[model samples]
Target: MALTFTEEQEELRTTLRRFLADKAPSAAVRRAMDSDEGHDPLLWRQMADQLGLHGLALPEEYGGFGGGPVELGIVLEETGRVLLPSPYFATVALAGQALAASNDEAVKARWLPAIADGSTTATLALAEASGSWRLEDIETSVGNGTVSGTKMFVVDGHTADLILVVARTDTGTGLFAVDGDAPGVTRTRLETLDPTRRLARVDLDGAPARRVGPDGDASPYLRTVLDLVAVALAAEQVGGAQACLDAAVAYAKVRVQFGRPIGSFQAIKHKCADLLVQIEGARSAAYHATAVAAEGSSELPVSAALAAACCADAFTHAAKENIQIHGGIGYTWEHDAHLYLKRAKSSEQLFGGPATHRARLADLVGI
Candidate 1:
């Protein structure tokens, strides 16, 4: 609640920041985004092997450190700052969280260890052609141990080793595990504004599948998983917003206009000051949600919605103002400013956008 980090947390942030600076610099990020795999496999392995990042938030019984949302948020925020162009978010934040939150021990035992060790990549396929993130809007259905439907905007869907498909069943909404390469599964990479993060369309035509969670209504469990993920995404947005503010201030200090540094101008100073205030507010919102998630508090839903709305808006604003501060140079293909803006805009819409989150927040708070 105080938004203060422990000493260890600060160390973790420092280590990850240094690592990203060395391994995931601008050129490296560009290379990975342009490559077919969309990320460096070697770096991915190193993250698991050296840093144990993939397992930081997983249960120790599943070959992890048994950390929670707070630890995962730290990792995500660091990765987001660099726009690392990796499937870490899809593999760990999305699928890993879903499996961990499920009611099936067998499912967790079968999949979580692989995820912790970074041996497998996976993603949750929730949104579809209808362009909705709500469980009630899901049209994918399961029958006779098979799933059939088209899932769009699946993060890392084309390359993930496993696909956790949210499908409709006679009982209620359920989670189905379908092997990425299984028969009757078709995956197509989609062209997106944010090339740093890849998305895909997955078509399942009677794909063999096994139910991962309860046979009865699993909507409640799925909703909790979604809330946790929203908090994690908010952490990432905070990092991106902070980066934009830093970049803008740094550029304003150096770039000259009217025989003086632009940062010395009152308008530029006001913009920087406003961005700092917004970023700090967003950071507090994200940190509070992370704490609530770690505590498994009943307030997670409200906190998550609040974080999602605040952080998304803050990140987008920071990115836009960052571009504005840099003037014409920021608009160029060679500049990294545009990439940050693209990531901000793309992530803002990833889980229903700021307006959707605000509406959810209002409904949850009975306002």
Candidate 2:
């Protein structure tokens, strides 16, 4: 499908880009990353109150704009470009999407308004100690109205007000809602490569749990949710890739070597040109996936897999090439280049690596 944006979508991108450039500058990002909360709460409120970002893609009855994946993708792309340190992704992309996709109206009524108004932070806990994202691999068990298991690599798990936990039941895999501070729940922040994003390990020892979706096997619904999340993440990856490309090109134009701008050099020019192509390709893939998701197409599985692989590889490549173009400065801890590289490397493995997505794509297409 052709990747096109409406005028309103374009305006959203422009507005969000300007807002982030003002509110989430490099210094603000560093401050948030180093803070215990891992993000600026006041800034978070501003995003909801001023931009209605928290409700951009939520249902209208739940205090949102009744938008869809495409709208959410636009917000994510802008945030990724600035490397904004916030729980927005965990709250909206991971947990919000899951809740919105759930069949239980009670669950949505009880939780979504809090999320929409920015009063609650939430995350979806799927990966276990095995570090697997597959639903069938889940070993966490739920019995007698409680869930017991340890979840690893949970985004913002330590601090979220709500945690949507994936657990195995007698029938099949299911999603459970466990309060972050509920009795028997333990959340620990884990040391990670990307300071801009926080990850946690959650131990739910017979925690009182409320089933969020269907009563029986929810694997199919959960799978769709995962696909949606992958597409959302791809949007973010494209934004990050574009940022790296822009930074590299800008630096090349100003930093002179051999009595001329490095951008005039064939080697630097080639690297920048290549990065631009890769980023644009990734952008298209992400945009296409978002469009597929918004339309609820049957082609979603194929499109999501394609996007997951393409965008991850492109972002990682762009980040590395950006550093190389900047020479020694990019390698320094003081420079922002390393930050982008860290985010790229970490995000590449978040849902699964590029290779994993490609393997899934092959299976999906019966290749």
Candidate 3:
């Protein structure tokens, strides 16, 4: 298969990169993170209404642009580079995918258009306080058109207009869509290392809910969404790693040490070289996974697992080394290196860690 992007994809990437550069600059990101909603409402609208990024991966019939995973990857990669602090991942990635996977026309009509237009924010209350993304670890329950349980570290849970909760039913595991402001739903914001992406602990006590799919059917679909999530995160990680590498390299070239540029030193040169190599490998995995996700093949899971594992290692390594390369300044909060480090660690654990993905890969390929 051709590894390079097509002309249309390249144009798409250029558009997103420019948009993010202008709208999601570092200052903008910091401002959004500090805001009560933890994101910029205006920028969100621009992305949806102007760029149509919110609907890139959504179906055309549902008021989306009729694109797929690759287009989403383009936006995600750009967002990662700038560390854009928004609910895009929670809303566009998780909630959007769940809604797309559902067969409920009423549900799609109710939420997809709003999501596509950026008028509504959405998230998934799937994981528990134990912070497990595994199917077996889910303990939420739904009965008589209501839900009850605790979901913790839910991405943008506090501000979501719609929430897709994974609940255990009498038949099997299922997905339930709940109104974010519905009665019996209480959200508590949690202070986190990655404040740019807000996390919340949600308590749902007989909250109004609607089933999205048949019992047990959610497992495969959830797995597919998780794979997509992994792909999106991998794209983000690769972007972050690339940014760190660039920052470190630029700093080393100008920073004086022993009457010369530190980049001229063998130690620093070797470190930067190693980081570039790792980033190159990670980018390959990330891009390949995105393509595979768009194609919707049987090997999608395998591709996603590989990409996630590679990205986790790459982003973590690059973030740490970036700090080292920045010397004492990197340790300070004033420097942007620490922010990348925090994001790297947070993304690494969001879905499954590297070990978890590796295990899943073994199972998927029967290795």
Candidate 4:
């Protein structure tokens, strides 16, 4: 599988980046983040209908563009740079994958078409209060056509039309689909470090749920979707890191100090250089993971884990360094630096944190 983007891929990035810059500017992000819905449905439609981004990776039979994971990675990177406040990631990376990978064709038929058409949105409700990525941490039970318990860290949970819940069943862990507004389903918006991505606490007390997969171990598909999500997030983190680095360099070049640009100083140059090197490394890891995912390579687990851990740290570091380089103004809420920092912090924990992925990596590599 090729690690580099093709000409068509580059064109996709250019198009997406331009679109996001015009429509999803920082002001738009601020407005969306402050709104009750945490995202603009209109913008979501524009992205899906106009850009055809929502179906980039699904099969053409499902109304998709029949692209692959690399295309999705490009879309994610561009969206991350602008902090797009949409449920595209949750819908595509989480629920879409769960349905696509599950054993039940009925569930796929019921969901994939609408998802591919961007008519409905969905997310995977996996991690619980334990804050663990392990399937065992899922306390929700799926038995007798009901789901019981709570799921925390559900991305875009409040707005998802459908929720693919991971729950324990009589046979083993299984996947279940529950309507967002179904009876006994409660979603409480949680105040998060990053309001750009709305998170909610989902409570299911005997909520009506239909089985979406076989009544057996769903670990393989679960892991597959989670890995893809990790790869997508890693791409986003790399984008944020690159943005922070660019912002720091631009500021350092213009902000005069001692009658010259502050960037002339050895200290400032060293900081920027360090960030550039790390950001590039993180980019390589994320890109390689994306390419691997696109090809369905056997090395996906290790690549995804590495991308998750490396990109998380690199993005966080780049954001912190950007703030440090910017001095006092970066700390203010008005500045965009803090927004990227908050996103970095929030993303580090989604799906699994760097440390969690590090452990997973060790096991996968047999180290």
Instruction: Please tell me which predicted candidate would have the highest lDDT against the true structure.
Output: 2
| Candidate 1 structure quality by residue, lDDT tens digits, 71-156 | 89999999989888999999999999999888689999999999999999999999998778999999999999999997556999
Candidate 3, superposed: residue stretches over 4 Å from native: 215-217
Clashing residue pairs, backbone N/CA/C < 3 A, model 4: none
TM-score of 3: 0.97
TM-score of 1: 0.99
Task: Please give the range of 10 consecutive residues that has the lowest summed lDDT in model 1.
Answer: 1-10
lDDT of 3 by residue, 220-293 (tens): 87778788888988998888998999999999999998899999999999999999999999999989998888
Cα lDDT of model 2 by residue, 192-219, tens digit: 9999999999998989999999888999
Comparison by lDDT, 2 against 3, better one: 2
Cα-based lDDT for every prediction: 0.93, 0.93, 0.88, 0.89
Worst 10 residues of 4 by lDDT: 96-105
Better of 2 and 4 by lDDT: 2
Report the number of clashing residue pairs per model. Answer: 0, 0, 0, 0
Q: To one decimal, what is the Cα RMSD in angstroms of model 4 from the true structure?
A: 1.1
